[model samples]
Target: MKDSQPELLHLDSDEMTGYPNSPLPVLIYRQVLDTSNAEERADSFEAMFKRHGWPPAWRYHLYDFDHFHSTAHEALGIFRGQARARLGGPHGQETVLKAGDVLVLPAGVGHASVEADDDFCMVGAYPPGQEPEIERGDPAQLAAAQSRVATVALPENAPVGGPLAALWE
Candidate 1:
């Protein structure tokens, strides 16, 4: 059976304790993959990132608390199991992500895993030559983090689409 086009979800920011949430909307692409093998699915996600000019991907689970990447945007593809995640900030929306789901988070957008199954895993990647800096809602570094986020360049293509990621444009 042919799969349908994925849906796009744009989430706005809500002010956190001392950090300024991202101004860009968080993009969610549901069921981007269908493979059941964890390793195969992760490899597929990595291939997609490479094709879209994003590289240096890694495999891991998301941190369980609210955090943001100050320097680079991130793409997370769920390869196994499922989880409920909070996006935007402390007061952001809660969303469920299952295997095959993909989430593209713009710079400085907060995300946390509220709950997850034991088998949950994800493949994460960044745009070419971009290194991610972790910011854990630190009040002292709020200004610096916000500045970095503002200056971060938007990726030329969305991780899932080489040049046709309409939601990213």
Candidate 2:
């Protein structure tokens, strides 16, 4: 968390690069904010987006509803929780509604989740390549309706032992 750390990130804009052919956005598993007050959440979310280029024009949300967050990719979480997603399948094939579940949606993949309760919070991720078309129920539905979506294309200098570690190497 040092301010002196290098903040600049460079990436190849073409698919001809050697990086993994990522079709969907990399879904990140971030914890819920411990603080109350919408301002704190807004501020924290703002910082994350700014530091990682999750544009203000992009669709992001802190949903105060009961819902499931699913898309593609997998094993990009901190906690050990049960998650189910049928690779290259249609909607309803994915499931990850637990206390600490981190699911990622890869390119060309689609998913939807069922909320256990009527309250909670969630973040979303779309596909990569030529921007993805995503769909969610309510609260986070606006992001689903966008023309295209963008996500952080695993940085080259990111730390080891992360979800994108091997790819970085």
**lDDT per residue, candidate 2, 58-143, as tens digits?**
32322222222222222222122223333222222334433233334443233333332433333332222223323333324424
Off by over 4 Å in 1: 1-13, 162-166
Give each model's whole-structure lDDT. 0.78, 0.31
lDDT of 1 at 54: 77
Off by over 4 Å in 2: 1-32, 56-88, 91-103, 116-130, 135-169
Summarize candidate 1's per-residue lDDT along 32-125 as a digit string, tens digits: 8887688888888889778887784678887898888888889898999999998866777899999898888888888899999988899898
Which residue pairs overlap in candidate 1's backbone? none
- Worst lDDT run of 10 residues, candidate 2, spans 4-13
- What does candidate 1 score on TM? 0.87
